[model samples]
Target: MALTGKLEIDVEIKAPPDKFHDMFCNRPHHSQHACNDKIKGCDLHDGDWGTVGSVIFWSYVRDGKAKTLKEVVEAIDSEKNSITFRVLEGDVMKDFKSYVITIQASPKSGGEGSIVHWTMEYEKQHEGIAHPEDALQFAVEISKDIDSHLTQGN
Candidate 1:
């Protein structure tokens, strides 16, 4: 079965997309203990940081155990300030099989405001492995944290 969700948040970034994207995609910059010690590492294997098709590996704690997630860039539109990535291997790989996550930002009408959108699409291996809404809520929380960090002048 297929599952999907969308999350939206308002943010004010001290830096532009290029800067914001680079910092967030890098993972380490925002994965500190205070933010989330669960992450042990995130590496971009191909192309430069924030470029389409770059692979990233994330190590984290899940279910009281350590797990790693591997993902690849599926799409990117700098002009629209969007990037999409698909999970390839790792803990959730067995159950979800595949997942696509996208992040995008649009300039608010006033030019001082901005809206960030986070979307996820996934295919489940079994009939009842994970609830789509649960994943969506987690994604929303992560997005909110990221937005808050940048807007807080971090």
Candidate 2:
């Protein structure tokens, strides 16, 4: 019954690593266009997309229930193809005191596709709250949708 925990998973994609990085760092607001069902909307609240300190709001469906959350772009490194998001409000905030998600896409050695790594670190509001496994799965699906959309013609 630890108050803090970390969950990590990796998803393989046919698209290149740069493709994944470009989407999250460049046109994240258009993610809904990639997956209409999972992601309902992505709006910019402050600063601009692809830059650090930007605030973004997301509306989506997770586990058959509608959910919403806001996050600030904590960091983005093009060289490593990594981006970090610090959760600020909405559904996730209700159960956790702090939530941070970091995604990194890297080329698989001697392979055409990329390996996308997901890391979620959070502190529960109380010991009763379960770890956010569903949320991480939801993120995986979202990344897959974006990968499909971006690599459509390539």
Each prediction's Cα lDDT score?
0.63, 0.92
lDDT of 2 by residue, 36-122 (tens): 998899999999889999999999887789999999999999999999999999999999999999999999889798999999999
Alpha-carbon RMSD of each model: 3.6, 0.9
**Which RMSD does model 1 reach against the true structure?**
3.6
Tens digits of per-residue lDDT, candidate 1, 29-136, equal: 355432474455676666666667787887876446788888887787877777888999998787776777777766656665455666767777777775555555
Candidate 2 Cα misplacement greater than 4 A, ranges: none
Count backbone overlaps in model 1. 0
How far does residue 30 in candidate 1 sit from its true spot (Å)?
Answer: 4.4
